[model samples]
Target: MNVLLIGSGGREHALAWKLSRSPLLGQLFIWPGNPGTASLGENIPLPVDDHRAVSDLIHQKGIGMVICGPEAPLADGLMDFLADRHPDLALIGPGRSGARLESSKEFAKEFMLRHGIPTARYRSFGSREAEEAISFARSLGLPAVIKADGLAAGKGVVIAQTREETETEIRAMLEGRFGQASERLVIEEFLSGIEFSVFVLTNGDQYILLPEAKDYKRIGEGDTGPNTGGMGSVSPVPFADAALMDKVRDRIIEPTLRGLKQDGIPYRGFIFFGLIRVQGDPFVIEYNCRMGDPETESVMIRLESDLLQHCLDCHQNELNPGSVRVSSSHAATICLVSGGYPGDFEKGKKIEALPQTQPEEHIFFSGVSSKDGQLVTSGGRVFAVSCLGQDQLAALDQANRLADLIQFEGKYFRRDIGFDLK
Candidate 1:
């Protein structure tokens, strides 16, 4: 079957790698793909924002399926457009109505609250309602989380430890530091605990849960500094035991699917839950309508199932959890982010020697390009070096070892990517 993959990031690279391995695949095409995907499939230069062009290409190529890898296009109703043009073509991603879980933080929080899903207490506010927001923050006390209501490319949320910091964050978000994304804010009580990412392939009724993963979001080592898209991640998270997975499905995932179904938004693709294990109980932090970045690198590394078949099953509403397969082993990924990431950072800097990996190890490129026939930095999180192992420690060791070989000016990566498992 002919397939079209979207987005340009490490996650898309990993997805391309996996999809290319499918024996059922005839031709694979990537839209605005990066250097990595260029090696695997036809990299089309069509404008990703133009849904009409994308639909035209899909029809021209007889594309059997279109997999969206990022939230932007999904949030902008790309799936809806595709469905409108060619309802028979399988589109693996949520439509705009179903994407509200990620596109609007306030809507997600309110939905969770209404449906009895476990989550942090939050209050939403517009920029003009400063006094009301301040009062809500004061009631929630210090050490609150201030989050921009719209997507801010993963830098919208700020953990404020004091009243001064909380007020400053509120001011910055309301003052347009995050552009129009911060026109509204959601202030919530801080929930301190270990966090994990859970991915589910859903057809709005039936769902198949993939292995859990833990991502390091902080840009600095030892879990300090600002949050980036993702610094690193480890898959088959040991913390998510069978009991915890059951609780997640019963108390969170199932309810969420049911809620969306009742709300007239029947989702039909990946559903990513940002979860926190607070006091031994799981609580959702946020939701991503699609796959998580570095986390996808780790998860895909440990997947023993055929990704193409699984996605087809989801599209057909025939997802059989029994047919799904995943590795019992663990996998870890370390992200090499650009210097000054999660803030202002320079791009187009020449990247030196990259690590040589055996077939056993996976190197997914993110924020990189072949400029003048030489690899150069292009995004915040540049590369995700991933390795599979029997355990988390071994995986971490392999991931770090691979990361050490890649050299470039202004390259910064967290030294403790999966240390939380230790």
Candidate 2:
């Protein structure tokens, strides 16, 4: 088993390329990994808030399963500091109170209004409630959304549209523009439609859902500007049917895993959800303990199972809804970025040209870094490229033809990735 896999990007290089095609994989680390997870194995640059140097490299490399993959090291508790500095490893994720559903968007909208689930209609305020959060964003009428109850990496959401751009971005996110991750502010209620991504793999109580991406968090191209961290993605989401995934598994993933196991919260890993699709149902537009960058690089290349046996059956709680499989072809992940990305750019730069992929395309890097040996640019969504066709318009035409054979120096992307399923 011996895993580790924390985070560097491109969803930890697509879960270190599906945990290096597990045969119960016996050794694969990553931590500060990049260079497409250094060809799927040993990367560990350490210092993830130095929990005793990640518990002395998990007892000097006898790792035995970790799998985090970001949400700022599972909202900084780092699975309760590696389960109290190494309770025989095996973490996967979710512990800081089930990572406050995703680091508190007002505790995931009051734990989705205390478990009835379906979301949107938020309210959290603080920073001395800026005049009742500007009178609750002028009573939610024009377009409104504001968010930033913590965590701004995915650009702490905005969607303003007016009411003086929602009281000047809620007094500039409770005054600080995301410092202290916007010292409290939620506001929401602009729910319209179309947005997807589901993932699940829980152990808060038997779960396993995966396969249902749909990224493009607007960096321009018809979806207008601002908001990045995902420039493209897609995976069987031609409107997520199956009667809206059985109303998102009985109205929002079975009451968010029965309200995180009736609030005791021993969650195991990956919960994402995000969701949107209005008219046809499903709501929750947030919650992401992990897995959802370019929709995990297009759902880990259509996930043909064996992601280290579903993270060792979610660390032995033995998750099972027929144990994950998913490969109905049609993937597509694009990403590229670096040209004034999410705002401001430039990093190592080099990476001259790249392409000639084809074994159903792949790439995966993300903000690169190898230097002297080549591959440069280091962060603002750098390379994803995934392809695999036979549908989603031939995987968005072979993922924009391998994202135009990769160039570097300010190489933005999104040649209309999955243009809302054409």
Candidate 3:
């Protein structure tokens, strides 16, 4: 079937790779895709934000299915628009209303609280409540998490360790340091524990869980330094054993889907949960409506099922849990980010010594572009090197080896991506 995938990032590259391998697929197209996707299928030069243009392209091409890889367009009602324009085309993503779970943190926090989903206690505050928020933080004490209510491209949350730091964060967020994304803030109690990412493909009621993954969010090794989109990730997280996986599905995923349905927003497509394993139980840290970037690179490598078929089933609300399958092998991905990332960083720097072609080991390109026929860094996180093996250690080793082979001036990555497992 003819398929159209959206977005321009490493996650989209991985999706393209997986979908291109599906025997059910006849043709694949990626909109405004990155360099990596250009190698896999037809890279259409359609603006992601232009809804009408995208619809026209889909109709002109007779596209049968559309898979949205990122959250921005989904939150902007792309699915809703497509459904309105072409009721016959199947779209794999939540509509604008369902997207509130990711686009508005305040709404998600409140939704979780109302539905009794396991999550950190949080209080939403507007700019007028700045002083009250500071007072609330002082009451909760130090080590609080301050989050921007809206999307900020993954750089809007601050883990403040003290009252002074919390106060400063509130001021910056309210003052528009993160622009309108911080117009409202959600102060959360910091929960201590190991973090894991859980991905669920849901067709409103039925859901199929993918292998669990652990992501390194901090920019520096040893889990120190500032937060970033993601540094690296390893799949089949040891902590998410069969029992814990069941608990995640029963306690978290089920309730969330039920809640969304009760709220009149039947969610379909990928639902990502940012979870913190506190003690023996799991508490959600956040919700991402789409697949996580570097995390997807690891998870997709372990998937033994037909990626396109599963996505199509979810879109049609006919998902069969038995159809989903995953490999026993483990996978890992290390992201090579630009120098001074999660802060000020130079863009358009020339990248050299890159592998001649996409590695057979699963490499996803992120922030890169071809300028004058030369690949150059275009964003904070540039590329992801992913590998699969019998276990996490071997997978990590392969990922690191590939990472070392590619080089550019001021490129940096964490040396201890999956060290916690050791």
Report lDDT (Cα) of residue 378, candidate 2: 88
Compared with the true structure, all predictions reach lDDT values of 0.89, 0.83, 0.89
For candidate 1, the per-residue lDDT at 351 reads 84
Minimum summed lDDT over a 10-residue window in model 1 is located at 351-360
Query: How many clashes would you count in candidate 1?
Result: 0
Better of 2 and 3 by lDDT: 3
The weakest ten consecutive residues by lDDT in model 3 span 353-362
Model 1, CA-based lDDT: 0.89
Question: Model 2: per-residue lDDT, tens digit, 211-261?
Answer: 988888788887887777778888888778899999999989888898888
Q: Predict model 3's lDDT versus the native.
A: 0.89
Q: Which regions of candidate 2 deviate over 4 angstroms? A: 1-6, 12-44, 47-50, 54-77, 82-93, 96-236, 249-252, 266-289, 292-294, 297-331, 334-373, 376-383, 386-395, 407-422
- Models sorted by TM-score, best on top: 1, 3, 2
Candidate 3 vs. true structure, TM-score:
0.97
